[model samples]
Target: MPVDQPHSSAPDILHGWGARQRGGRIRVKGGGQVSQIYAIRQAIAKGIVAFYQKYVDEQSKNEIKDILLTYDRTLLVADPRRCEPKKFGGPGARARFQKSYR
Candidate 1:
């Protein structure tokens, strides 16, 4: 299911391993790293996606952006759970959604 971006403007990357689940909804839990984000996208584009959540500091926001652009696999879409509040958070802060796995 990979997007096969050879003809498109897709980035070069792919998804990774299993999710490390969490417990009762914490307030600021994250899933993957910036790299992992793209990894998830690649998974979806490739159609074998497993997701990771990332809880980054203000300093890392740019890194996350890099991940979004440099890798076609990392996308703004795909992982809706990751996009929502209980996980990825907002401009001022992030909220935890209680890890879905463990």
Candidate 2:
């Protein structure tokens, strides 16, 4: 809800400053350029996300690349534990954004 804060356990977006860490939230679509499975894995491991699903379809990957051609990479993400903390909570590698200088 807040730009890229992960969805919260409440489903409803947290109402606070635009910069709340909102660690309990997860954003499946990290919308960058070129998805990073390992980074997503780290985020999940860190409880930053509940779970993740990758668009492994080669066509989709290519499409992503095509759409992102103006940039460098794209990032895809998801969370499995949004409404349940006991069912989730840990430390995960935060999502990352990378691009070459224009």
Output the number of the lDDT-best candidate.
Answer: 1
lDDT of 2 by residue, 42-65 (tens): 343333122211424455444433
Best by TM-score: 1
What's every prediction's RMSD, in angstroms? 18.1, 19.5
Consecutive 10-residue window with the lowest summed lDDT within model 1? 11-20
For model 1, residues 1-102, the per-residue Cα lDDT tens digits are: 243334233423322222233333213225535444455445443322222223435444444445555654335455445343343543433644455676
- In model 1, the runs with Cα more than 4 Å from the true position are 1-55, 77-102
Q: After best superposition, candidate 1 residue 35: deviation in angstroms?
A: 22
- Decoy 2 TM-score against native: 0.18
lDDT of 2 at 1: 32
